[model samples]
Target: MVAVYGGRGPQTSNIQIRSIPSVVRRGENVELLCEVENEPDAAISWQRVDGDLPYGAESYGSILRIPSIQGGGIYMCSATTRQGIFDERFGLVIQEEFKRIVKLFIVNNISHSTSEVGKSK
Candidate 1:
C-alpha cells in the first residue's frame, strides 16, 4: 500500500492500501482486506463507520476480518509507528441486487458454450 502521512509521521516502509472490490453472494463467504507495511511493526486499529463489530477481533498485523457477510459502509484503519500514526479510509457498499451482476459476469460463461452446442446439435 502507498500512503502519505502528515506532521512528523513514522518512517513507514509502505504506507498504502490495496484496492479490493469484492462481489459476493449473500449468505456466503466474503473477505475485505486493508494492509499497511512499516518497520519494527506498527499498532493497527480498525473501526466501522456503521453497524456493530464482533468482540475480540484483533490481529497481530494490520489485518481485519469481517468473518461473515453483513451490512456495509465506510471503514478506516490507522497505524501508529514510532514516528506517528497514519490513517486510511475506504468505502464499502453491500447489496444483494449486485450479486446477480457478479454471477452473470463471473459464472455464467456457460451461456456462451450452450449457444455453441445448440448450433452444433
Candidate 2:
C-alpha cells in the first residue's frame, strides 16, 4: 500500500497529568507529570490552584515535584500552542499518617501477661 502525505494538517491541542496521585501523606513528597499530546513543542506549565507551589519544589519539562505536603492541593497543568491553550486540573488531598497498634498476650503456667506496642493516640 502507498500513502500520500499532506502538509501541516490541523491538530488538536491536549494536555494531561499522567498517573497523578490523588492522595498523599502529610510531610510526604510527590511528583506530578504533565503531558502534552501531539504537540511536543508546546510549552507546559504547572501551578497550584489553592496556593503556591511547595517550598523547594522543582519543575522541568513535564514534571512537577513537591518536596512536601505542606502545599498539597489542586494543581493545574497547562499547555500552550498556536491553536490555543489546553489545561487540566488535578486534586491532591493531604492525609495524616495513621499508626497501627498491636497487642501481645503471653500465658505462663499460672500467670498471664499483656503488652501493647505502638498504640495510637
TM-score for every candidate vs. truth?
A: 0.54, 0.68
Model 1 Cα lDDT, one tens digit per residue, 36-120: 5544467777776565553444444666666555556666777776666777776665657543444445565454433445465
Kindly report which residue stretches of model 1 are placed more than 4 angstroms away from their true locations once superposed.
1-14, 38-40, 54-60, 97-121
List per-prediction Cα lDDT, in the order shown.
Answer: 0.58, 0.76
| Candidate 2 structure quality by residue, lDDT tens digits, 1-121 | 1122345764565677864457778888788898776778888898888888878888897898877667457889887766677788998888777788989888767777898998987
Q: What C-alpha RMSD separates each model from the true structure?
A: 13.9, 13.2
- Model 1 scores worst on lDDT over the 10 consecutive residues at 109-118
Model 1 lDDT on a 0 to 1 scale: 0.58
